[model samples]
Target: MKEAEGEVPLSGGRITPDVVRVGNTVRRPVTAASEFVTELLGHLERQGFTGAPRHLGLDDSGRDIFSYLPGRVTPRFQTWSHDQVLAAGVLLRSFHEATRGSHLAEGHPVVCHNDPGPNNVVFRDDRPTALIDFDMAAPGHPLEDLGYMAWTWCASSKPQAPPARAQAAQVRILADAYGLNASDRAALIDAMLDRQARNADWWRQHLHAPDPRVASNDQILSRIAWSLREHDHTAAHRSVFEAALR
Candidate 1:
């Protein structure tokens, strides 16, 4: 269980710090959910889902070890190409289908990623190939992850962000790629809006005392502000989004 020599510090994302690359494997600090995540990864492996990393057990330091996925992670909140948007939807659906009907689903449709933003996605050849980070994974409605994706991958409050109509179109493309049923399609917008509001509210309490898990206070502020704007943006262009879905 000894950690290999020449450990390289891997930096990205805020919550999980002290991650190091030991050869071709990643060593991350074990969290309360580490056991569940490990089992989840194992399940994905058994199901032949290569979109996730393999759980390689713990290091000598008790850090969770996983086979390092090879690909560049997309920067968060950046504009996504139409193909990328479509690929994301397809990837998400595949992931959900992999977990559907599993005991881990806990009687729900599937275990939700809960946070499948661009930053968590690994891309190769300009196409999304994998998803990383499962600390927030839990059993829930599939729309929960899709809704979060809608906000994180499409909506933005930045000056150079896409227009509301364009964002709406991208959302429609994502839904189409996922091949949502009529009922799910009708509920997509509301789910996205609800996720936005919850995200903003979740950050509001952290304004005064930011969690050590987050990257920075300013980053938190940025997220809260972005979520609020995204909510408003989606709401303002609800008609456009609905039309595109049709």
Candidate 2:
């Protein structure tokens, strides 16, 4: 049992739970669901997946403690190089494979990171190496996870997003890296569209709330709208997207 050496505020999480680093551990306010997260992390560890933080139980303050993984987390909206995108795709596939046979992925549930965006990825040597923040983990279609990855990595919703052709090419790269089958390729765009719609609905529901979690709802709604429009534009040229992947 490693004792706390010191503590410092950890930033960037949207919910912004009381999170801090104590020596080699990260402590965050625990919820009723914390036990599930701890179990998930334990499953990942037993399966030999090294891409997630090791859950270290609770601290004296009753906050959930997780081993601190060392690496840079790419800031939201920051552009990534092609190689970085490829590495992210590979890492996500690895996570899916690791969780496939676990209780999380059995018929019991299809636990997904739910939010595997750049901000949640830890980069080492400029490559994505680990993922953190599994608060949104839940049962879902595996394609949903890939859709979230595509949305973030391809800059699908940004005003400065790449051209339609370029976006298609990047999507193809991601699909290829993840080893998606032809059937999966055909449904990729639709999956991404569904993810965008779901996110928009969540933000809309919270737009008028005064809670700290909803504080950024307006900005989030704007991004959702932008992303939906971009995705719609991409869908209009579905032939190009499908062709690139094929």
Question: Which stretches of candidate 1 lie above 4 Å from their native place?
Answer: 1-5, 208-215
Model 1 residue 183 CA deviation (Å) reads 0.8
> Which candidate ranks first by lDDT, i.e. highest?
1
lDDT assessment of candidate 2: 0.79
Local accuracy of candidate 2 as per-residue lDDT tens digits, 111-224: 788889898888899899999998888766678988878777874645676776787888888888889888888898777777777777766777767666645766877866
Cα displacement (angstroms), candidate 2, residue 190, comes to 0.6
lDDT of 1 by residue, 1-246 (tens): 333569887765556787788888988989888988998999999999989989998888888999988878765558989999999999999999999999999999999988898888889998888999899899999899989988787766666887778888888889989989899989999999999999898877777674464546788898788789878888887887788777
Per-prediction TM-score = 0.93, 0.89
Scored against the true structure, residue 155 in model 2 reaches a CA lDDT of 43
Global fold similarity of model 2 (TM-score): 0.89
Instruction: Return the clash pairs for model 1, or none.
Output: none
